[model samples]
Target chain A: MYLIITALAAAVATAFWYKNRLNDKLHLGALCLMYWGAALMWLVDCVAAIIAGEEEIIDTSLNAALLGICSVALGLAIWLILLLIRSRRNKSQATSINSH
Target chain B: MACFAAPLAEAVITTVLMKRFEKKEKMTDAPNESQAGIPWSRKLKWLNNLLWGGSALLALEHIWHGEIIPQFPFLTALKEPGGVLPMLGEIATVGVGMAAFVTLVWFFMIKIADARAKKAAVSGKTAETEPCI
Candidate 1:
């Protein structure tokens, strides 16, 4: 389910943030924030679903897994674009400094 | 039942506040090395990002599940007779709880970051990296 995927993303992102916290030119905070937000949201949804008893909480279906993957990919896609921009800016700044 | 709406509503308000605080911070002189710390606006940004990002996915999941519709009234729950009350109840409980929980977590994050900032500022260590907080 989404909760699981988001939680995994949050964990992995946290590891990355911890490693890069000191020299975070990549701005891994974006990844952490997005995944943590998503995980929190999905946690609420899972809890609500448990209360409503409308569906199984642990859905192992292919479609559900695919959807969760897509959602995570979307978050990663955004983070990747941010990283690229940051990288480009850093490169340009370095070039300017060298020229100076 | 549109539980994400509660967080989205809170995010809208917080986003406005975040912008105002950001503007105010911009107007102020930069904090000296001895006073290096996170601004109120930066702290608010943590909460704002969490709420906005979380709400987006929740809304998308709701739409995917057919709980939300593109048509008038939007929420499929509203189509059910006498459904408004239950839907409101869900929002009140689940939605509000979610927003409150996230706010609570953000509060803790700010507290920890503030503590670190205070320690760094007192020690005057550039290596402390308080600005990132």
Candidate 2:
């Protein structure tokens, strides 16, 4: 479920990036990369499950999902931290401009 | 079903809100050349926030359900009857629906922004550039 959701999100983000490639920014590209990375990780897990057979596929998939969720969460955290720093810098710039 | 629906719904709602806020920001922030052509960056930021917020909520939900134990092979809770199939089904339905919704909204936003730009051009406010994506 997490896999499908992130994959879908990644697809949408990628399309947006493609259409606006000339004007793309680092953070946006990072976001697309993050979701695509998560989706790819889950895809590997799915492949592993196929190799493991039915008896172990369930356990393997569950573990994979957990790891996928964790990775997504970590990616989000990093993005948010970056966003906050950017916003703060922008704020300070604006304040200096106004004071001048 | 609701379990999966929760994250999908959250993602959509957050994306909408973030997009709205970004639009407001663009309007107030003066049309700099650097920002003018990069409308998709705002959309990307919104989508990033949605994904991050949704993932965090889902993690908390999993923890509440006791699916995140410290033991090896954690998430044994998902091995219950019916397993992850139902959850996957719900995610598929909701994810597709939300994706379609966001796409439609994005298309409309571009359309409107283009129209407004054309109007500006006609009124001699600004020269018409390429349509924003």
Candidate 3:
């Protein structure tokens, strides 16, 4: 579920970025990287579990999954902060330009 | 549960990293350039799409496997026989498939953008520049 929600959020952001390609001031590309990195990490983990047999290493796989989820969450937090900072900076720049 | 704690920790780490990056961006006076020719912002965009597509595909697989339920405490459904490991296996399969698809699209987009730029250059016209929204 965590993976699903995070994925959906990333997908929505990507779509938004594409739609506003003409005026992509926010740099959503970073956000996409973070999400995709997390997804890939989890995917690798899933494969490891299958190759080893789930019953043989359930606890280990669970820990790995937890780690993957944490990384995704972290990526999201970073993206949000980046968005805020970029927007603020852009606003200030625009205001200065207008004043000049 | 680790699931709950992960997000909280992630938030803290993200905050620290963003602050560091912000300071660096300020110092350089080159807001877009961070680690070289490739802009950090653009890199993030591609990465974000890849993950989003992967996650979506994984979710769909989970739904097919009955690992995901629409009810309350949805995650608890994974506590069955094979447990979360099997679900992870499914996620891996679907995630890779989707990531590949997203990558292909990204490649095509880049190719198109490059073509447009080349065309503009040949015609002695300024390429359309992207503005911040």
| iRMSD for every model | 2.0, 10.7, 8.2
Give the alpha carbon lDDT tens digit for every residue of B3-99 in model 2: 3344455556756777776777777764643335335546555444444444444455456457656675455435567756865654565444444
Mark the 10 consecutive residues where model 2 chain A has the least summed lDDT.
A37-46
Instruction: Output the TM-score of candidate 1.
Output: 0.83
In candidate 2, what are the lDDT values of residues A2-99, reduced to their tens digit?
A: 56756776787678766665565445555665565445434444454565463543333565467545655666677678778988999999999999
The residue-by-residue lDDT of candidate 3 on A28-93, one tens digit each, is 666665565445444454555677577643334554455446655666666678789878988999
TM-score of each: 0.83, 0.36, 0.40
- Between candidates 2 and 3, which one is better according to lDDT? 2
**1 versus 2: better lDDT goes to:** 1
- Which structure among the candidates has the greatest TM-score? 1
- Model 1 clash pairs? none
**DockQ of candidate 3?**
0.16
Which model, 1 or 3, shows the larger lDDT? 1
Instruction: Give lDDT tens digits, candidate 1, residues B7-50.
Output: 99999999899999888778987586336557778888888778
Complex DockQ, candidate 2: 0.04
Among the numbered candidates, top DockQ falls to 1
